[model samples]
Target: EFIIESRDIVGNQRVIGDDAFVVEVEGPSKPQVSVQDRDDGTYLVSYNVQRTGTYHVRVSLDGHQIAGSPFTAQFHPGLVMAVRCTGVGRGLTRAYAGENARFTIESRDTHRNKTTSGKKPFVVTIRGILQVQVHALEGDNGEFHYSYRTPRAGVYFVGVLLDGVDIGGSPFKLTVDPGPAHANGCSASGAGITGGYTMVETFFTIYSRDYYGNQRTTGGDVFSVEIGGTASADMRMRDNENGTYSVAYTPMIGGDYFISVMMDGVHIQGSPFNIASDPMPRESYLEMYRSMEPTFKEKMEKMLLGGDVTGVKDRKKANSRRGKEAAQQKSWVLNIKLLDANRLIPKDTTVDGTYGTGLVQSSDPYVVFTMGSESVRSTTVLKDLNPTWNEEMKLPVENRLEKLKVEVMDEDLQDEDDSMGTAQVSLTDLVIGVPKMVTVKLKELNEV
Candidate 1:
């Protein structure tokens, strides 16, 4: 609607109407228009268009164009047609988590015509873990641009509203992907790193997170871990595919170890973790070194020779408990046609100080064989109750009907060797040329 006032050549307002006024609208479609004279030389023009487009409104007086002859006007749909609004941008498809997301909206009517008037009243929202805030701006043109952001990744529903009404695509499905893992957000955990024991299989776990402190759901995150110091060794990593990884490593030699965890060539939350691994127990040396070599005695000798001893130490004794367990054990493999003294009674008592600190319960025991007219004695074993003396001992056998006597005795450092027990064997009916294995019962021996 518009009002026009007539004037005289002297620029004075006219008191009464004089000339005829003409109003015409030119556009793609026709519209309802009307002109009214107010009797005071003023005219009123009102027009309403059906469709939306650019139109020219012309005003003329007495077959001649007025001072401002024509005016350009744009017709847009009303705000009631918000459901016809359309949105377009990359944010509608996918977005990167912890980053800005943007898109544009074109306000339209039922016929999809651009709108130029209204309060807008646009409400944009994204359904995510966090309450996202949206910012909308009106461009110089009739387009509406909206932006929003969130730190979480997932399939989120986005809504665009205008005047309390949903837009064409109100619930936009937006897929968010996790960003790269951040150093400060990644962390490590587990027994291998915090509560590690030497010469034992230990493992740890690593968790990966993004810059926004959100856990990544998928794998493909690369990491580098290195163990250093006296317990240095290679660490193995297993990807759990859920932002967590398992790291495995064994401390061959116990001491201090430094564990470094890195993600994407950068240090994680607690990189270079320090841990002190305690040495393995003294009794477990056999089990620990058995896998190191094929033969049991070779592994023991190697461990003993390398001074890889653990547990308590007493620098004064000429024969330590460990030396007694390994050296005096005499655990050799037995060959055919040989007399093998496998093991005897244990020497070390449960109480400490096997070197005689007032207690003399255990002893050093050996095997003695009385064959023919001569008697022979093997070396004595110290404190280890479970001894190994596998060997091949050959003696002259003159009489096949003669009996052989075998005895076990404990050596007394201050007196004569005491007899623990004795086994009596008689070879009177033995077969010649063929090797013979005799079994005998000891007279005074209980199972050790």
Candidate 2:
């Protein structure tokens, strides 16, 4: 049996037997509806309405109009401005007659509204009489473009049409200059270290411009920089954290090194500067651990409270019990690895120096850990000093530590004492190379 089922209106919600839903509308005037009928009876239909006007969208049942809405189609007017006939060839006053010219269209409309089929149609027109063919853009944001050719080399007017109406008469000009031309320029600025280059790391300031004296820094184009040949990388001038780019390069030679800066893949021609790197002093690291020795012994004493042997050899028996308890409470351990080959290091006796490969020979010898793209906190959790290499390092969060970095620095000698140097290192001071990075993704511990 066929039922009207409360009637259906175009663009309105429709609920079918229990849970299914559908929206129905009358087809547009120019194109008929593209509908597909299911064996169960629901029809999947689609169509497009070309121009702006009030039209009826009818829902039908066996060729009879059951329900409908008066759908209104309107156009929105907005502005699209562009410089016409931009030169494209290597040399130019203007490009050749048939050559393809490139130009940028600056479209501005704070209110983002559809332009083609609203209540009011958007009107468009251009000056120059240059004979051109134009077409509407098919993308989401309403766009229209045109192509033209110089017929007899005289001035011309380009006109725009919208909803069969012409827009404001004045048009953008395209001066066809005869040519043999070229263009070029450069950029430069002062660069100095701020903060401690070793402990705090630093940034450099640079002011740059282009060949035509155009401020390239404001152009938002990215700039690439490479420090010492081995430690090379690229960065955008605009992406600098504070009007400066930060890169860390360890100068093995300890002298002035030249830095190369390139913009838009083309070297800025004359933007190279000499950066001085002082020699890194001898260094050593010390890590301490909070052993659970006493806590374990106290727990053993509590267990013996209920049981008693009247004369259980007081001193010797108590000592053995305390030792057993201390062993059981040892859960977390901390360790520090002393790395020094190029320089000598005095042992912390608590930390074992594993004479491993790159031990002291490489500047980046410390164990570094990172989360995705961000640095995580690192802390010393255990220390063991034996001829054997055995120690443990804890995660920073475990100790309620605010920072994740630890470094050893000594100026007078190759090794520094535990109390002589600083313990907390801020992650911000370290600039990691391009390929190496850390990123952290924390799942919400509990949903509010």
Candidate 3:
């Protein structure tokens, strides 16, 4: 059933009279139905189309005429579009009269190149704050169909508008070169070594080139070199004979460096050859030389101070306190990791080896101590079965006391135990003056 409402009068609706409509079908016609009523001086109506195929329906009431409904058995075809250019892609924007910028529109998706689906009767939407002018193309397929132009030099948004709604904002970039002021030749050079340090310098030769590569050898404006790194000052040059000019620099140190040349303050590629330091003398000490050069030493201190290799091979000799006897008496907590068999004895104990007498055992009851003493030591263990002994020990300073010797047998007793393990012991010196502690540990590699 179909119903109709009046747009001129609010809340006014009507049902057509039963005899007021005439319906016809292309093929065989079927029975139709209509309902009609009159209330409060307003008419009301409802009707239904029974048969399919092309049909015509006319509605009239009270001597009033209405438009007939002509129905065709077909689907709705929406909108389509095309775009064209008045000129080639080279100067699309140059064709502008007043503020109209020009551009070439290409299908964003390459797959749509052969598409004729929506080529005509479609809408175009340009997005951007700037005003844009476009011309609709007439043909279905062409390399560049649409011609778009812009008003000025700024970012512009362009896209397709369908059914009064925008599709996507595709971007286009426009660049305009103002052309060279004059021809400027790109040139460079380096600083000379005075004393032991080298310097850097640079210059330029202005040469103008046209869009066709024609050189303008005369009347090119002079540009300056931009200062960077250790360069203390900035300098520029004036055009000399022909187009060559000069600039200079004194490098802070010896080595490879870059001297950037510039125009006004804008950078132009003018980095020249390496600025080198005076050759270092053959027999000079590296440490002395670096120290004399404040900048060099400041850079390499972390590399030079890394290890403690001051010619003293023995640890005891290294930690010896020669001048003050009271300070020499200071005690350090040392971790003496003994051979597993040796842990039974107290750590830092002195161990003297009698090679011919064979292995030493924990039962030797040796005194444990630091590198400086013989008489001062910690409590000792009596045997291996009673393993693990600990004590704070003191060392003597009169002799070169590097190794914390573990004495297995006293010279007077002449008795040595044979159960010592086969692991060799390694001694590492601790840093001096840093109140440090040492722990002696033991691990048995080949279990006994």
Candidate 4:
């Protein structure tokens, strides 16, 4: 606060009118100033300071300098003013999954003094498609360090907490990008053709991707299809532009046909799929019942005689039936271990007009085991590229030929979970009553 007094030329004090005097102030930052005219020929001047610096206050009466003319005042560091993220890599708002992301923060007081003395724990959290844990680098001062890795792709909110309260701009947003393409397999599916005439059109779809789960959208010219057997079909392939392809063909003859698909010179899984150009004729229910009567009668007689009625006269048929029943009755024990992943495909999604790409540094990964229609999931491993879960499970194999599907997925809260990779193992390849330590290499969606 500043005060000023006025006097008349006759040495008598005079009252200063509001318009008779003017005050001007200059500082490093904009300052709020106010003045009041007193009835006793005095003036009161006040101003609010924002930053620490020297201020110049000038007084003038009727366009002439007052006794003091100009006054100078200095302000030192005061209370905490604002905290912000600063320094190198401070505002890095984007990163790839499995890649490290870092940022630094600094706090200052109103007087522009660095407040780096206390041990005020800085709490940091990331929330988005998934929730992740963030750790500050050792040492806590006005300057702080934060780092994290996200496994899934999506927008994430990075929040910083000081003294259990959020500072200005507490939460920062970042985009995560999935990594480079590493599609390792392909899958094919479509509508089956039944007894169609010559020149009848049928179509199938194929999906291709890398081992890291990245889809293949371009360079699809390498995809090829071959139809063998009785059907001589003209095949044409079309790129769907979304990591998939459509193959449309017209059959020239009626009979059985074998369709083989290849991508990048490698045969995909389930290649050489068999299809019928001409649908097989259906048998009447009465005729089928009549044909089974002799076998039914033989089984009924054996049952009444207290013999094994499930046995069949044909040795091959009996063996096949017994194998199926045994598979259904016996439970297989499997010990699965999720060791690690190599060059995993990054996953990503968009949120709030921002594109988030890349994989999180430490992916919270889990595994799901699927056989037939039943599925079981393993416990999640947080923030680890190489997760280990040596777990044992007992499952009933209803079909000996059914493949056991193992899918690796990352856990997320805000959106659908992401898949890392998948591998299929046949029960026939395992030895019963023996524990096999199998290393199942994961593959992308369309990878073989």
Candidate 5:
């Protein structure tokens, strides 16, 4: 039933008299409808549906359709047979590998009554990354179970068949997660060149192990390095041929550097190590400068004017050039609004072969705006297909020809975040002082 109020031209509620209103319903078999006049500027419409289909109910004022008319309603036949995982009466269900899962199929007649007297033999089958064994419970009606550990990780299909016909909610899907990483007995510490001079090389060591405390000899594990200081460093890691790994750090300028190490995307023990380096001696600094060829000095000077300084140079000239370059750089104020998305792939996977449902299945989307090496990100919009985020940012643009890259990613808890799509906008065409609204069409990563 729909409640519609009529209003006059001046926005006052108007009473629709009995003679002024008419109601008609069009459906599959032309359901009989009755109209009752309440005499208080209101009318009641009642209809008995005889068929299962869509119906269009139109309300007219006098001989014309009202402001809001022709509403649609759909009806389905009464519930027939329903099937679900034993413990789960309805909706989605999940189970882990090597665990027992039971399914219960409930049968109901057309009269909306449950009956098991004429139950037929039901077939249950499991298929996916790997097939598992499924068997019917002995002496149980419409009950079956499956127990088997999958060797691989992926989605699995569970199907229930009654009299060779698929029942309601057949071919249920489940997901399987990768096996545990067994990262229990790992250790990391500073091993070499705890302190050094600028441009000098230093190193550290990390010992990786599994949950059993046995050293991991395999080389598939990944390690990352992060350095924090005014000046950056060249950092890389190398396997020491033993179970331990060696990380090399070469300081670019003299200062204190904080080093952080991560294994398998997690921080290692005793991370954020501090290493101190002294400035190069005057003699050493001069020797490095003199080692350059005569023509190379001019190239070096040109690079230093652009903030790429290696050797010590005239401070006054370098500062003056830097000031000029800073003045020429443009700063942009951006008002970003993340509107919505369409046709996004599901990223959540489980060991039971069930993908996420409802909000869990939707993406926790966030936008990352990048220009050259500088990047800023908007706050995450949780579990929505049409997320609205009106955020603004101010950033300096060093290169006018560089395109602004926008990447949409889905945040995950168990693994690496997944990229949904990306878009690019050319900044050179945008007016400096004017704010322009742009609708970026997100495309797959490989799409140009």
Candidate 6:
């Protein structure tokens, strides 16, 4: 509405008089306007618009527009209420957990007619697996847009309020599902991964995760397992119908084995867990013990069972205490006795690696006596810090070698055998017919 006051040509104000007043309105669309002359030198103007916009009003007297008669009038929608407002678009109903979810709302008046908003007229929030606040942006086109995102997959509710009042459908329900898997999201674990044994089966588990870092609820993901170290190694994988997978492998020799696990050609977290395998027992080493004298053999069995070793108590096992001269007499039976080791270094995360958690830890230890092409390996003592192998095996009397290479190693079910230490025992100074106990300290000692 606008008011206009008129004066005479002499600039004298007229208290009561008649004047011809015409009014016109123009804008996005012409509006209906009315003009009333009070016959007292004043005029009143009013207009009604159908759209929300700025409208131009022109008030003229006779043939010319009155002072500032071409005026600007801003128009806006009527009072808006919460019950008439509503959201639009697909994003409001569903979206992935890690991606943005966007939707828009149309604010309306009590009569359900489109309306414009001032600043910060609506409050939004989300609740369910997670609680979060939402910010809405108002557009001149009369739209209130809102967006949000979450890291968990589950059902959620979106609540909207206008002018401190809840909307007609105040809280809307939304369903979020786990997104596609990513290399950074997947993971692997288990006993086999920590370590393994040679010629023995080892196992582990793999977990498939989604973009949001949550394990997927279903399975059927293809995983490839590769083991490297010796030429003969085999790995197997299985799906447990859930997000987890089972893996198993066997090593042919004692060495460091590198394992790589992949899902759909992508590396899982901690893909290559390694293994330090202990020397594998072979039939040839067992065959070497079959020819020893029964008296010496009977004592060895007692020692292996953690029994007392009364070495060469009877003359039946040895002639007398002969010196190096006896070597020339051709005693084909050359015996080497293995005693118990003490204070050996402990290697963590072995087959016993199930430490602290239901998992057992410690090294499976053993001894290997290597001489040229002839190597004899003793039995593996599982999960032992200090192990005893009082067994005596016969070696062929060869004049060529003066020392025997003795190595103490820790056996793993997964990777290569770890050398605890090694020592060379001097065979030249020993008495031929005497049973002796030689304490060989294995370390990085240089050969003389």
**Clash count per candidate:** 4, 36, 59, 33, 8, 22
| TM, every model | 0.48, 0.22, 0.19, 0.39, 0.31, 0.42
Tens-place lDDT digits, model 1, residues 1-448: 9988888777787768755888999997787789888889898889878677799998888788778779899876654477788889998768888788888888777767777665466788876556678887656345888787888886677888776777887777677888788987888766566756665667776878888776676788888888898946756778866677778887788788899898778899878898887765555554344234335544464455455333213321323444344432333222223222323443334442322224434667677777666566677667533333544465555443456677777777777877767876765333222223343444433222
Q: Candidate 1 regions off by >4 Å?
A: 1-80, 116-119, 282-294, 297-448
Candidate lDDT scores, in order, read 0.67, 0.34, 0.36, 0.62, 0.59, 0.68
lDDT of 6: 0.68
Better of 3 and 4 by TM-score: 4
How many times do residue backbones clash in model 4?
A: 33
Candidate with best lDDT: 6
List of clashing residue pairs for candidate 1:
330-388, 346-385, 347-383, 348-383
**Which 10-residue window of candidate 6 scores lowest in summed lDDT?**
350-359
TM-score for predicted model 4 compared with the true structure: 0.39
**186-252 in candidate 5: lDDT tens per residue?**
6665433356567756666676765434444445566677887859888887764335676777788
Whole-model lDDT, model 5: 0.59
Model 2 / residue 405 / CA error / Å:
14
Report the candidate with higher TM-score, 1 versus 6. 1
Please identify model 4 stretches exceeding 4 Å from their true place: 1-21, 27-30, 35-44, 50-55, 61-121, 128-130, 133-147, 154-157, 167-181, 185-204, 208-234, 239-243, 249-448
Writing each residue's lDDT as its tens digit, candidate 4 over 182-211 gives 324567765532224344466776766554
- 206 Cα displacement, candidate 3 (Å): 17
Model 2 whole-model lDDT (C-alpha atoms): 0.34
lDDT of 3 by residue, 1-448 (tens): 3543332234444333323333332323443545433433333444333332344444444455445444433212222222221123533323321233444343322222223334323354444445565676555432234556543333234554434533333222233222343223343322221122332232223333322233323345556554444334344455532323444444445455444555545544333333434433322223232223445543333334334543332422322332123233445344443221222332223342421223433354433343544445344445343333434454444432245544332222444433333222223322232122222332332111
Global fold similarity of model 5 (TM-score)? 0.31
**Candidate 6 local lDDT, residue 146:** 80
